[model samples]
Target chain A: MAKPLILVTNDDGITAPGVRTLIHIMKKIGDVIVVAPDSPQSGMGHAITLDSTLYAEKLTIDEESEGIVEYSCSGTPADCVKLALQELMERKPDICVSGINHGSNSSINVIYSGTMSAAIEAGIEGIPAIGFSLCDYKWEADFSQAKEYVQTIVEQALQHGIPKGTVLNVNIPKLTKDELKGIKVCRQARANWKEKFDKRKNPMGKDYYWLTGEFELLDQGEDTDEWALANGYISVVPTQFDLTAHHAVQELNSWNF
Target chain B: MAKPLILVTNDDGITAPGVRTLIHIMKKIGDVIVVAPDSPQSGMGHAITLDSTLYAEKLTIDEESEGIVEYSCSGTPADCVKLALQELMERKPDICVSGINHGSNSSINVIYSGTMSAAIEAGIEGIPAIGFSLCDYKWEADFSQAKEYVQTIVEQALQHGIPKGTVLNVNIPKLTKDELKGIKVCRQARANWKEKFDKRKNPMGKDYYWLTGEFELLDQGEDTDEWALANGYISVVPTQFDLTAHHAVQELNSWNF
Candidate 1:
């Protein structure tokens, strides 16, 4: 049997520890190809470069990465996937995996996530996809602890293709492999950010602000992704790109326009 | 009764003709305050400025905008909403309206729309919101045809209040008011872009690419937003920021991971 081809990408730049670990893990399962942003695209959602030009350069990141194909792209996470599927790759990949991100993308973060955007982009193209993230946000955070679990999930996804019209958003808790219980499938938790912009002045007396926030959890559901991650389990949320609220369509139809 | 305070924004920047026209119409319905990006932010899906500082200036675009408070912010559409809700506005707005966008955000385009991002951001903040877009992509696109329909929807939304956990995404076809049919409550059409990157070389022999795509509609459903727009009717899809695929949860749970 021919080896299944896997496309690897992330919101963090290709040099980030998180994606480097992801590329290493994916290589064990199938033929590996990496096309990711040259800079971090943390909260870029599903953004694509329309008004600007994109550059993709093939490079060797390390001595061990000589045989693996990697392209550092000057675009968002979504743009990397689009360029790869449309132009870079010779044939369609069996699956696309994004992240092993430097931070959590659980609950409400999924909407603002560049990590999940790449996975969602591949899912839209009818390829099985998954986005993995660690609960830690530090650049030097431990990713070695997630190797076995990440590999298992990727193997399973390739074995049983993800359901159509959806991608997997996987978030791992900041716990040792021994302390980490296992994986659980859950729905996204309802939440929002309490944003506060830090106001400052420039030398010219111009007002500038830096955005900061605290995550506010609004749901108490045990079946939510938040609950799973909080309980030391890897949370796999089946995420979709379809923006429609199917349940509300009926009620809205009765209204006169 | 006191007039409702309406917040207006768009991805096409604060001064685009589409948003300018939106401000004029919204002013008639309520007290209008505008907070939009300082430059065009097309295809900027849900992006928020995290690693940089943002500058928001209280600017008056013209003499006609004297009394109405408007701020031009150096950020994405979602960032503008966050700034307005968190810092700029003195009080919580009654409703948030985005766009009268210059192009179609009818189906798959919704996932990549900065217009809808502002509305979704407001929705996450527990505010009733709606995003409006014209199927025409011209800067000088005739927005006069959408005046009556836009006002009716906004008024209806304020009176009835949108359902909890949802925002409205309305797309108007490129047609005169006479040729335009009425509004229709619809689901987002299932579609994808057949993206092709135009590759070229620079003087230094380095390659740069321009991204372009053609919309490919795959659904035959008559109740979709694409169907509505094609039939000369305005389409209103109840959009949600929650990315969870509820139906696929049970299936994923059965997987061994």
Candidate 2:
């Protein structure tokens, strides 16, 4: 039987250690193809390059790889997935995995995440997808501890299949292999960034602002991803792209329109 | 009684007719403050400018307006909202209204809409918010037909708050006011873009591509936003930022973790 075809991509540029680790792991499971951004796209949520042209080029990233190929695109994460599916790949990938991102995309951060947006784009195109993120946000963060769990989740997703119109947001807690607990399928915690803009002036004495914020978790529910991560467990939240608030439809219907 | 303080914004830039029309109508309803992008930010969904310094400057768009003020920001729509709320506004807005966008943001387009993302950002910040868009994509599309309806919706939303954690995605069909069949509360139709990349060669003899697509509606439900728009009615889909697929949690939990 042919090995399952796996598409690998990320928001943190092609050379980031996080995606390199993800590609390394996916190679052991199937034929791998990597199409990612040429530069970092950390907070580019679902953005597509509409006003500008896109450039993608084939390149070699690994020396010892046999069935692995890579391409880097000059666009957002969502753009990379769209380009790969429509122009690059000959057949639909069995699954697409994004990230092992340098920072967490566990809660409300998902809305601003380039990482999850790639996975969600694949999900929109009828491909099973997952986005993996680590709790640490360092250039040199250790990714070895996540290798076993990452392989396991991808293996399970390939076997069981993710539900239609949904993708997985898997966040690994920052912990050693022995200190790590198991995994938990959980809901997205209700949380937000309390945005505080640091106002400053440039050399010309003109006003400018730097967006800085603190993540504030509002949901204390044990079933939430926040809780699972805090308790040393990896969190897997089934994220969907259908934005309709289904429960509010009835109440809205009651409004005189 | 003091008028409601309405925060107005859009992805089509501060000078676009769509947002200018929105500001004109909103001024009749309240003391309006406009904080919008300096240039078009189409398709920049929920994106924020974290890696770059942001610049915002107060400007006068309408010389005759007394209580209306505007600011142009060098950031995404989501960043504009965050700046308005954190560093600009003296108090929380009574409500936030985004767009009067030059194109539709119905169905799956919501995932890639900067208009709706601005509204969603406000919703995440605990403010009642709504995003309005027309089916017409032309820069000079007539917004007059939407004025009365917009006023009514805003009045109603201010009177009866939107449900917590949800923002309204309102799309107006391209029809005369008399030809309209009123508004419909609906679910987001299942749909996706059938992407077709127009590959071309650049001046330097290098390959480049232009992203283009056609919307394919997969859902035949009569209660969907697509159905409402095609039938000459405005579609209002209550959109939420919490992306968790709650119904799928149980099924996913069945997997061995």
lDDT of 2 by residue, A30-121 (tens): 99999999999999998999889999999987665445789999999999999999999999999999998999999999999999999999
Residue B8 lDDT in model 2?
94
TM-score of chain A of each: 0.98, 0.98
Model 2, position A90, has a per-residue lDDT of: 95
Per-model TM values vs. the true structure:
0.99, 0.99
Off by over 4 Å in 2: A64-67, B64-66
**What fraction of the reference structure's interface contacts does model 2 contain?**
0.88
For candidate 2, write residues B75-170 as lDDT tens digits: 999999999999889999999999999999999999999999999999999999999999999998999998988998898898888988899999
TM-score of chain B of 2: 0.98
> Per-residue lDDT for B125-231 in model 1, tens only?
99999999999999999999889889999999988899889999999999988999899999999999999999999889999999998899999999999999999
- Candidate 2 lDDT at B92 equals 96
Model 1 per-residue lDDT tens digits across residues A1-257: 78999999999999999999998888888899999999999999989999999999999898766799999999999999999999899999999999989999999999899999999999999999999999999999999988999999999998888989999999999998899999999999999999999999999999999999999999999999999999989999999988799999988887779
**Candidate 2 — which pairs collide?**
none
**Per-candidate local distance difference test:** 0.94, 0.94
Q: List candidate 1 stretches off by more than 4 Å.
A: none
Native contacts conserved, per model: 0.93, 0.88
lDDT (Cα, 0-100) at A257 in candidate 2: 62
